[model samples]
Target: MEKVRATRYVLPLREGGSMPGLVEADDDGMYVVKFRGAGQGLKVLVAEVVVGLLGRTIGVDVPDLVEIELPPAIARYEADEEVQDLLDASLGSNLGLDFLPGAFGYDGSRVPDAATAQAIVWLDAFTANVDRTWHNPNLLWWHDRLVAIDHGAALYFHHSWPSRAPSPERFAAQRFDASTHVLADVAGTTAVAARHEELAALLTPEVIRGVVEAAPEEWLETTADLPDADAVREAYVACLGARLAAPAAWLPGADR
Candidate 1:
């Protein structure tokens, strides 16, 4: 639980959109460092950290998301050509995804069954996450299980319009996709079958509260003034409840 500090050395990483220089830290610990001024809000970083921590608790696979405090005084680019090219293309933009170096995709042929997809859909819906589609398969295949990644888009679009109603598009779309696949894979042992009980047992109200509570208060402060801290906490619970109440037989945590 020691917080890792960001330092001067840069390691090359495959570039992600909206940012430059996928570099590794010098501290010997592995992490993708997104510098502070890198276009994204602090909340996105907080969301990645919070959601990642929560997902891991219930058996979901998420990359380790951590914040690296880069020194503004440090000269930005290094001499490395690959890293330099990426930096040049993405100059003045603020954001970076620490690379998940050495991770590879699950064979496209072994596409996930509907049941596990159901769980993924449900999880994203519950969290109000906006990522996860055909374009960027944030779902990584590690150890024969679908690992979730890139949640900087969750609980989003709500920041701007505090009173805005939630959109069901992402939830509906994922459910539709999962249902079709689930039926197709009825013969196989789906992921939900193996871990639904554990996920259910772990996703208690307390666990949800702990993650949301740990979210940076500054992010909340930027939003419309919630009546009080409890009010903010209650809102997140309501959002989670809506997704959980949906009938998802293949949902890993639904029955438990």
Candidate 2:
């Protein structure tokens, strides 16, 4: 991912818990910045990049990701205390998604094609993402195209890392409940099952490692179990690989 410095703080996008802010970067492009010091911690950022790369690997319409450098001086002129505190805490590399100007939140009015819908559902199911429900569709309608966003909630298994060790088998065996998934009805679990191998083939071991590597080293939280960033990346690769290897265990059997 390309790295850019934040030139200006535009505004706080206070929608979700992370409260990603809108900021202009040195490249003269605007991006939605997900802070490293957000309430969700660095794991959210890791999930965002990892899942994002995976989604794009299989041809999902996701935004371009970049590393936004938050220099100390960038927050000097912030007037809002809350926003300033967030900026102060997030004083280094943060995740930046290309801001699609004029993009509106997804509504049932604009539907994705069957192939796209199934791809989205399969990606979410494979990643165990539970946040793409109707109420919180992490999707956007951009210029008549459906775009995927906000994957910070996908890899929930990592949150358990503080205490438990990374368990590939467990995550592999974890069932993905697509009942609340926004594209559940549209994608239909049957088609998702049919395309399992076809989609899974897109994420080769090299591809998985490449996506995991996209995450900045600073963001990969080092637990005692995983001593270094590379180890953590390996752990992610293992978990994802295990899940892909054991589809029957995790793939939703029907449209529930």
Candidate 3:
């Protein structure tokens, strides 16, 4: 991903807990910036990039991601104490998704077709994303198509790394309940099952490695268990690979 310097802190999108902000970059593009110093920390950002890349790999529409450099001055100009605090903490590089102009939130009325819905469900299930529901779809209707967003909630297994070593097997065996998924009715188990292999094939080891490596090194938090960024990347690759190899464990409604 290309790196762009944030020229201005436009405004905060306060819908979610993290409170991602809108900002203008040196590239003359506006982006919804996810701060590295948010309450969720860097792990959420990692999930966003990884799952986002996976989504794009299998033909799901996602916003273009970029690394946005946040200079301290941007935070200084913010008047709101809360916004200023967040900006002050997020003083370095952060993640940015290209802002889609005139986009509206998904309201279930504008559902994607069976194929697209299947791909989305498959992607969500594969990544163990639970945020896409009636309440918070995290999806956008842009250019008359459904664009996936807010993957920070996916890949929940990583949050445990501070307590224990990265466990690929556990994540692999994790079952995903799609009953409440936003697209469950539209995609159905059959549609998702049928597209499993096709989508999985697109996430080859090389492809997975590329996605994992795409995450900014600073955001790949290092712990005593995972001492370095490369090790953390490997852990992600292993977890994703294990899950892909054992579809019966997580793929909802797959014949075991």
Candidate 4:
């Protein structure tokens, strides 16, 4: 991922639990910055980078991710107490997604075709992302294309680290219920199953390793069990590898 220093904090996007901010960077580009100090912590940022990279690898349109350096001065000038507090806590590097101008939230009026929907379903299932439902699509229709966003809710298994040893095998066998998925109606089981191999092939072990490595070292939290950043990265690689090697357990409607 590219590194860019945040020049300004434009505004707070008060949508979900963790309020990401819209900011301008030194590269003269605007980004939706996800703070490291947010309630969810560094694991969420790691998920954003890993799943975002995985989505892009499998032909899902996702915004470019960059590491943004946030200096202390940027926080001092904030007028809002809440925003200022967030900035003060997140005084270093944070994850930033290239902001798309004039992008509209996805509505069911312009549904994607079966193939596209299937790919999205497959991606969500593979990652165990439970956030993409009617309540929160986490998709944007920009430039006449469907762009996947906000994958921090995926990879829920990581939240248990330090307390419990990493369990790749358990994650591999986990099941995903697609009934509430935003694209469930359009994403038929047969289509997703048919395209499984093709989509899964894109996420080779080498590619998965690269995606895991893309995460900022500071964001990789060291736990009691996983005592180092490299160990955390290896845990992610192991979980993703295990899931890819055994998709039947998690693939939506695989038995059908």
Worst 10 residues of 2 by lDDT: 247-256
Question: In model 3, which runs have C-alpha deviations exceeding 4 angstroms?
Answer: none
Alpha-carbon lDDT of model 4 = 0.92
Q: What is the lDDT of residue 222 in candidate 4?
A: 85
lDDT of each: 0.52, 0.91, 0.93, 0.92
Model 4 C-alpha lDDT per residue in residues 17-122, reported as the tens digit of each score: 8989999999999999999989999999999999999998988989999999999888767899999999989989999999999989988989987877998889
Q: For candidate 1, what is the TM-score? A: 0.64
Candidate 4 Cα misplacement greater than 4 A, ranges: none
The true-versus-predicted C-alpha distance at residue 186 of model 2, in Å, is 0.8
* Per-residue C-alpha lDDT of model 3 across residues 18-60, encoded as one tens digit per residue: 9999999999999999998899899999999999999999999
Between prediction 1 and prediction 4, the one with superior TM-score is: 4
| lDDT agreement of model 2 with the native | 0.91
lDDT of 2 by residue, 107-149 (tens): 7887899899999999999999989999899999998889999
Which residue pairs clash within candidate 4?
A: none
Q: In model 1, what is the error at residue 66, expressed in angstroms?
A: 2.6
**Native-vs-model 1 lDDT?**
0.52
In terms of lDDT, the poorest run of 10 residues in model 3 is 190-199
Candidate 2 residues lying further than 4 Å off, grouped into runs, are: 254-256
